[model samples]
Target: MSTTTETLKSQWEALKAENPHMRIRNAAEKLGVSEAELVATSIGEGVTRLRPEFAAILTEVEKLSKVMALTRNDECVHERKGVYLNPDFSSPHAGLFVGEDIDLRIFLSAWDKAYAVVEKGEDRDKKSLQFFGKDGLAIHKIYTTRDSNDAAFDVIVEQFKSDNQSNEETTVAVPLDIDEKPDSEIDVDGFKAAWIDLKDTHEFFGMLRKFGVTRTQALRLAPSEEHAHKIEKDAIVKMLEGAAAQKLPIMCFVGNRGNIQIHTGLVRKTMWHNNWFNVMDPDFNLHLDMDKIAQTWIVRKPTEDGVVTAIEVFNEMGEIIVQFFGKRKPGIPELTEWRELVASL
Candidate 1:
């Protein structure tokens, strides 16, 4: 190893000795390096660097059986427990995981660094596969549960292990821009006309790109109050409570640049603690930074079934933190209770 890398490794070790509970992400920040770099230091010690063949790795992930899939951004963290199955990698840059319990939209381009980590616990070793973006931020992670196939995990880890095991310092580029356009410059008339002509909810992203406006900007200039109305910041908590009370099944979508993790079911427990709103359940957990939510909107989109409504929350950066929708299939109409619940907000 080079002198600088050796020094970083030593510093990381010393920091771990000082506080063994310090997370690797926090430790990387403390040492002024990327989390990938910090993890690379322990390549041979319970950690193995994997080749950046994300699709193949995901295919192999199916063998691990039951595991927890985790995806997070700066303001939201989503975790779901299930098996990884039916991964469609037809597009090199984009992929899909269409499992009943674990649903994910994968953007493979953002995923650059991959690693298989084996952490020693009090009783046994905890194994995981972690993926990072070009900026060295975590994109997605899969953790092996107690019921996971340990033999399958070991085989895949050994198969995909990288030959180059050097503990070298690495540099990361600045995060990608969101391609946002100023609201003042956007042609409001054209944007409104296109918004009104929308046929499917999936076309929303293309509409934004066509009008050169950000999602938040489109919400602001949505032509009519019925189409998009601003809501109280605490509306999320209200919606969650309402869902729980009515026993309404809902879909929660939380994602970063590289992946979108979804939880579709009934959320029984809604919790608030330390300025965070959380959905704490047995199979899924959602942690949202309530303080970071600068705006909340009730957005209506026309689908073939009917006009579907959603509760969309945005962070201070105008990026979506989390979105909530009434659980309904593509052919089914929106639930009347859900619409009423959102309207009550």
Candidate 2:
């Protein structure tokens, strides 16, 4: 090991010894390094650096049977337990793992480094496969469950293990800054017309790009209150509680720049811890920091079947934190109960 890496390892060990409860991401922030960098410090110590055939590795994850897929951003963490199913890697730019229990939207181009980790717990060893982006931010993670196929996980780890095990730093890239056009410069009439004439909810992203308007900006100019209206931040709590109370199946989407993890089912349990609002279900868990929610909008979009409704939350910086939707598929209209629930809000 180089002198620098050795020094970092010692420092990290010391920090962990000081506070065993500090999460790796928080520790990395405190140590002034990327989370990937800190994980790389333990390269050969129960941590195997994996070759960057990300898509291929994902295809094999289904063999693990039951595992927990985790994806997070600054304000939200999404965890869903199920088998990785129906991987569509046909697109070079992105990928999809579509299933009833586990659904994911993977952006292949954002992935950079990967590692298979085995951490010693009080009773048994915890194993996981973690992927990071070019910016050293986590893109996605797959962890072995109590019922997971450990043998399959080990096989995958060995199959994709990289020859390089050096505890070297991850090459960090600067984040891109895409400037949005000023609201005054945007064609308000054209944008409003397009929004009202939308055919599908999926076209919303394209519409934003076509007009060079930011997501929040578009929400602000959403034609009228019927289309989009801001609600109190704590509306998330009510939404979750209401869905759970009525046995309503809802969809929760949490994502960052690289991946969007989704949970599509009923949320039964919910609670508040400090400022965090959480859904503590058996197969899925959603942790959302309510304090970070700057704006929560009840948005309505036109679809072929009918109008689709969503509750979208955004952070202070105007970046999306999480989105909630009624459980419905293409060609199916939004649930009347869901609309009534939103109306109640």
Candidate 3:
């Protein structure tokens, strides 16, 4: 068979390999359900029937197919084994999202990697929701409507592993800086000036700390907390300088209304294995657990800032972990559907 044909076969086997006794969502933390479709698929293929309400699945599944293609072979080190999937999902319905890629090690010990995608648009006669996996495997599911958390399609991959049959994965994050922060390696006034001016790349993270902002708390900002708890200059600078020391990769993203997200990169070694801070194989891929890394980034701060903010950090990945963003002003950048579609990891 040709490469594409072989690839399809591999994916089909992978999908079929999933235990029918288990739900479509492998992780208990999975945010959505497939019980209805799961029943449809288990009913011996063609014999399976779809409820009138199930028409939604077809449209969304189509969108999901398109989205999965976007994530193929993208670069992301923080991504856990199961494609760096969620450790504890809060969304009521499960949908594969293509935002910032995560480090699976931060959440689970033995990460099970899988490709994630989701369906989009609404039209039963038009499109359907589709999900795919790593081996170019595609499984189409129908969905009439989606909850806010729906974004992509995904699967738990640990059961296929010889050693990971019974164990669960937990996500953990690693800090970038190895050296302790000196009280002196901080400056909030400078950061404050940066926030107000919005010109020149001024770092305001230091001041955030003065307002009692901390690396520990920075990662917990909610989806709607665009401007959550504004902090003083000193606090912001301290957090920036301190986080930069670890050389952590910032975890920001573009969200609703073209918002730019600015958050700390507590999950170190997520980009390239920091030769200065990590150990790796001959390929130099950091051997650290990715599940742990993702938990570190997510648990640390909620995604803040606007779309421009995430792109800025995306290009700058080094000792200096800086973040400065604003709302959608004319010249300022905002989040975009394409940016999320192109995310790495």
Best by TM-score: 2
Best by lDDT: 2
TM-scores of the candidates are 0.95, 0.98, 0.22
lDDT of 1 by residue, 114-233 (tens): 899999989878999999987788899999999899899999888888887777736678665667776778899999988888888988999998988988889989979999999998
* Native RMSD of candidate 3 (Å): 19.2
Ranking of all candidate structures by their TM-score, best first: 2, 1, 3
Q: Residue 31 of model 2: what lDDT?
A: 88
Poorly placed runs, candidate 3 (over 4 Å): 1-113, 116-184, 200-345
**How would you encode candidate 3's per-residue C-alpha lDDT over 1-345 as one tens digit per residue?**
345334433443465566434423332213222222222222222122222222233223333322211111111221111121233323333323232332211111111222112223254221223233222122222222322123343211111112322112122333334243443454444533334443322233553455343432332332223323333323322333333454433343221111111222343322224321222222112222222221212111222343333222211122212233322334434434323322211
The lowest-lDDT stretch of 10 consecutive residues in candidate 2 is 169-178
**How well is each residue in 1-345 modelled by candidate 2, as lDDT tens digits?**
788888888999999999988888888889888889888889889999999999999999999999999999889999999999999999876799999988998998888999999999898789999999877778899999999999999999999999999899657775654567788999999999999999999999999989889898999989899999999987778889999999999989999888999999899999988888888989998988877788999999987889999999998888888999999999889889999998999
Candidate 1's TM-score reads 0.95
Clashes of each: 0, 0, 107
Roughly what TM-score does model 3 have, to 2 decimal places? Answer: 0.22
The alpha-carbon lDDT assigned to residue 257 of candidate 2 equals: 86
